[model samples]
Target: MADGRVDFSTPKGGSGASRAVFAHFTLRLDPDRLTRLRSPLAEIFDELAEEGPSASDDVMDVTLFTMLYGLRAGTES
Candidate 1:
């Protein structure tokens, strides 16, 4: 590997199963909150999809999700 730890090309498992089976998950978001998030998510995807190849490299998904998560949490709380 480029990081000098392990080769990604190598097989890391046997049955190809993920160890993170719903661990440390958060509470379920109600249907109303989910409906509210849909439009914003679509807008984000649409904006990204229409961007040119030379677009800025500073865009971050975590920041966007964090903002949305905070807004949703505030409304529910």
Candidate 2:
């Protein structure tokens, strides 16, 4: 969000997530580092996507999971 806008017009393909998403913005964060970023990332998606009501931008409802933990790696899995 610091700069530039996301271009949802074109998409690429790969073996994993890159196959569907047109972009992959990395977060300099550990899965266990608690933050408010999770909400806006997965929550607002459905409101606009609407379960793929159209023939395009209709990807499956994949698990949009997020995690947060202490600064150091913990014993938790």
Candidate 3:
């Protein structure tokens, strides 16, 4: 496990549901790889940040799944 923290915050009005939702996570990786991973991760999180309250649950699910799939695929290459 690499030693570091990555944080993500939603924009003031971007959260989808009326109820509260929270996500906190830690990723362990080589320090040298952190810089390479940050940009793509940020891009994924940025998409989530732009999702409006009107977005359907299915859409959100797919978006999240796609992010994970892409990351896995990238790492396998």
Candidate 4:
């Protein structure tokens, strides 16, 4: 099986807020499955933003998830 690694950061800011906040995360998963999940993940994230407190600008929303690093390997290193 092929493995893929994703390292990303999510920007955090509430509407009209000037301060910048960011959260970083790294995830390892099957590449093929990750590819298949792209669309669905996007939809789910969007839905969460739209249906949660973020919709009212009362909470910080992850406006962007920037991938900073990635690696793939046949075995864990």
Q: Among these predicted structures, which one has the highest TM-score?
A: 1
Per-residue alpha-carbon lDDT of candidate 1 for residues 1-52, written as tens digits (9 for 90 to 100): 3765332332355566542222243556777886787788788778866873
Tens digit per residue, CA lDDT, model 3, 1-67? 1542222334447664433344556566765577677778887678867964555653332224322
Give the Cα error of residue 61 in candidate 3, in Å: 9.6
Supply candidate 4's per-residue lDDT for 7: 25
What 10-residue stretch in candidate 3 is worst by lDDT? 61-70
State the C-alpha lDDT per candidate.
Answer: 0.51, 0.49, 0.50, 0.57
Assess every candidate by TM-score. Answer: 0.36, 0.27, 0.30, 0.29
- C-alpha root-mean-square deviation, each candidate: 13.8, 11.7, 14.4, 12.9
Candidate 4 lDDT over residue span 1-77, tens digit each: 03522223343553554454466777786777677757676787788768866446444434555553347567957
Deviation of model 4 at 64, angstroms: 2.5
**For model 4, which pairs clash?**
none
TM-score order, best first, reads 1, 3, 4, 2
Clashing pairs in 2: 14-19, 31-67, 32-68, 32-69, 33-69
Residue 34, candidate 1: C-alpha displacement in angstroms: 0.5
Give the runs in model 1 whose Cα sits over 4 Å from its true position. 1-25, 55-77
How far off is residue 10 in model 2, in Å? 7.0
